[model samples]
Target: MYSRSNNGARSHRWTATLVMGQVLLWSCAAEAEKLPHNLQIHGFASQSWLMSSDNNVFGKSSSGSGSFDFRELGLNASMRPLPRLQFSAQMLSRWAGKGSEGNIRLDYGFIDYTVFSGETSQFGIRLGRMKNPLGFYNDTRDVPFTRPSILLPQSIYFDRTRKLALAADGVHLYGERRSEMGDISFQAGVARPLVRGDEAEAAVFGQLVQGHLAPEMSYIGRVNYELDGGRIRFAASATQLNMSYSPGEGSIHFVPVIFSAQYNAERWSLTSEYAFRNLQYKNFGAMPDMDISGESYYFQGVYRLTPEWEAIARYDVLYMDSNDRQGRKWAASGTGDGRHAHNRFAKDITVGLRWNITPEFMLRAEYHHVNGTGWLSTLDNPNPADMSQRWDLFSILGSFRF
Candidate 1:
């Protein structure tokens, strides 16, 4: 670990870098305003009050203590550099007061090409940092105000890369088709998993050992069908597991499957999802390996009492197949990571509120009680606790976008 002095240095460095980015963004926006024709630029910003706590119970529990948590900042911009094409990017800055944090990082940046048409789904390719559309939520992640819970479904798949995972250098093919049942769409691409830029490896990043969950190459595909009444989504992807996952570096493959179901109307709505992973290696070796598998499911109901107010409650659970025949192959080979690395499960319950202040802004609040192994099923575990289920979190956010 870096010395205490280095901690301050790193924080200072990030602050400086963040300031520089802000300056550039603002300068360009002002300059663009002077241009003529269709030149337009727009963006939004938001902040929150976060709280997390648990009563420190043991074994199993349904809910946890709640306390003040972290704060978040986000900015998004769209520039019409040309009449037929549009460009956009978003950035996020987060902090955990009193010196606790995951780290400073980049959120996303990508360019889009749109074809003008009313009856057809246009062709577009987004290049730069890209979202891994393993499921429904991953694609709609940027719009926080549109979600039910304050925190996302950490159980199914929340890769460190972004929401579950992100990729560099990718091309996406997408189109929309409509039917009496609903509107259908699809996207597929290839990308390099780069979640471990400079961070320490988890003693066990979930089922993964001490290597990247994403491989040198990964393939992604997704489908969504929506009707006036409800929607259904499915997604799948495969990546080459790192050597630690496969004794022989010759070759390896891992597939992840995700499913989501959601229903919404003016008065009420519900949503749920499940995700699983399977790993296989090319060579038959004596090295210990695990075919780690995980399952996550949740149900939520929301009642919009009035145009300006709403209430919601949700239950979520996550479990791993680490004890299964091939589960051992996925355990990390080290012992210095976070708790939940060796455990088989984690679960939680969340309650939330949404209030509309005006057409341009909204506020959200949430409370959660975490249990079991107490880590995200979709993420690598750096610390493996004694298999206790006692953690808590709370958050409130204010946002606006168009």
Candidate 2:
């Protein structure tokens, strides 16, 4: 049967990823020994198997055995040529359904110059391609060890718009101040977001259009406060991300603001984030000028069962149109079929377990009960009609880092 063949293929892919991951890890270890003390090399690899009861996630998860289409590989190096100057770069390959097909690409490459350094305070400038400081997790979202969960809360960190949020090309200024009271850190940047991809085009135009999406000038910044060495953390971030559709077409503009807070303890942690998004479309003749506001938020809790084991639970929500939370208004407006109303919003409940087998190896499993397909990748699910409003997903992942 076709289902059997598909399942077999997925199994093979999963096995292949595991073998590749081991090879890469060994390779990194070998190279690390040859590198100089000033030059440090590190990398991580993760592969995930996902299955859904009703909808697709990270590939054809709705099918018999789920999909083995989720994986991440990263290699990074940092060198300090001088005490005040450092160079860092990372190359990443990510496979997450049809939106990201595991292409090797530059994640970030930057030169950092420290203008001032004190016992408790420092200021620096970074030039070149740098990660956007959006929230607590954006800077290191791709690394399994750095993430609190297998997936960062999708409401605030939607994979659908990942390229735009991942990193930007330009200059950033950063400062840090630490005292007995707490620590304050900030990073502000002027850059151009990445906007060339099927997912990016679909997100901006509601569908892939005839023309291509081009990056334009954008600004991003984040400020954070930590108390008692991260016992408590809070942050505020904002972005003005802009892009233009070339070949004599319209333009797209996005402005989003986010607020984040977290509490950490020896045994447990609590975290929350909220975001407000504004979007506009213009100049495309038949596309009609439009303006929309969206909202997203999530609350999560993590408990450490042991030094090497942890459990996590979270609730995340996203709305395409703040005014139409239920999506009935949009359904009635007839822009599309009424059945697709579920696309306007999504509510997700997730729970997961993580086990650190070793300092460099980890295994994780998670489940998600979701209502709505608001964040589904258009490239993965080209036919919205076949999508189910409610779905159940289960996933397992193995990760290694050196």
Candidate 3:
């Protein structure tokens, strides 16, 4: 009887040990499955060579060797500590001639909290530095893979004034609604615009001033609609960016509204955007009280030759003053110099090709026939007297991502 009882006890102990081992194995599997949902990381790097016939672009491109001055590097990470909360941040270093100078800066750092989430709808808020949803590519403009060409359409995405439109410091609210017919989404924010860069100074004041420009409260918002899971998309965005100068002077304000649309298919895509900008200056003595409206627009098309090859074409135009499309009125009025009239508008025709060697690597080449110097960098072309009315630009770029 004792032997039988001892054997039965040993069997029960073995059963308990097997069950505990199974539980431990299942727990490890479950943890492994949840790893992907908890954290993620992404990054990209790119280098470009540029050459121009007459004008300088992305460094001294007119030289025989061209310019190897255009480079971009960025890294970003995101983590979800809870089902309804997330944290994200990115750092960027860009070397685009004198304008960017390859300074390492925080591109975006934000905390996102979802207040309500459902199968078909969701609402959330973000706090900290956030990318401004200005046009189709503004939010992800720095990422080379996201762009159709080596350079974005300058008419709407002017590199000269990129700092002001890149991102702002403050709060953003967003919402999304989905359905079988379509999906609609919106993002609105109240933030302080970045106004302390040389590029911003040149864009706003026409030149770098002795006194620095300071940021003030500003507002920005965008609404978007997508059909058939983004086969067709449309968006409208607007911003009221405000700023003031020191020494008890006056103020400057910029209000821009943008409309964007795109259509995508298996082999080709078409994209277009239009922007109207209103600028006003007040109370600054000796400086004329200026109120002007500018116009810009572009049409672009991309064709996919194969899974790895693509071609692109775009026509972009910008007018510093809608009323003075030819710049004659401003020239006659003598704003500063009559020769500066050529600085008031630009029209560009571009064609480019892209090759995706792999999912993580790409090479691209492009050419631009541009008329007028309206969007030329003031830092690179400090003296407008030397600029040519018409010029050509060629560029090659290689990019990698992970």
Model 2, residue pairs in steric clash:
none
Total clashes in model 1, counting residue pairs 3 or more apart in sequence or in different chains: 33
How far out, in Å, is residue 121 in model 3? 0.4
Error of 2 at 51 (Å): 0.3
lDDT per residue for candidate 3 within 1-402, as digits (tens), equals: 000113344455445434433443454455456457677667777899999998888789988789998988777779999999999998777778777766567899999999999999999999999999898999999999998899899989889899999999999999999999899999998999999967788778767777779999999999999999899999999999999987657899999999999999999999999999999999898777889999999999999999999999999999999999878788788874646677899999999999999998999999999999999987777778688989999999999776
lDDT of 2 by residue, 12-65 (tens): 555655565665777686775677779887888888999999878889988889
List the candidates' TM-scores in order: 0.73, 0.93, 0.90
Which parts of model 3 are misplaced by more than 4 Å?
Answer: 1-37
**What lDDT is obtained when candidate 2 is compared to the true structure?**
0.87
Misplaced by over 4 Å in model 1 are 1-8, 17-46, 55-69, 82-84, 96-106, 114-118, 157-164, 198-200, 203-215, 229-254, 279-287, 322-342, 374-383, 399-402
How well does candidate 1 score on lDDT at residue 226? Answer: 73
In candidate 2, stretches whose alpha carbon ends up further than 4 angstroms from where it belongs are 1-26, 31-34, 337-339
Candidate achieving higher lDDT, 1 or 3: 3
Query: Local error of candidate 1 at 202, Å?
Result: 3.0
Between candidates 2 and 3, which one is better according to lDDT? 3
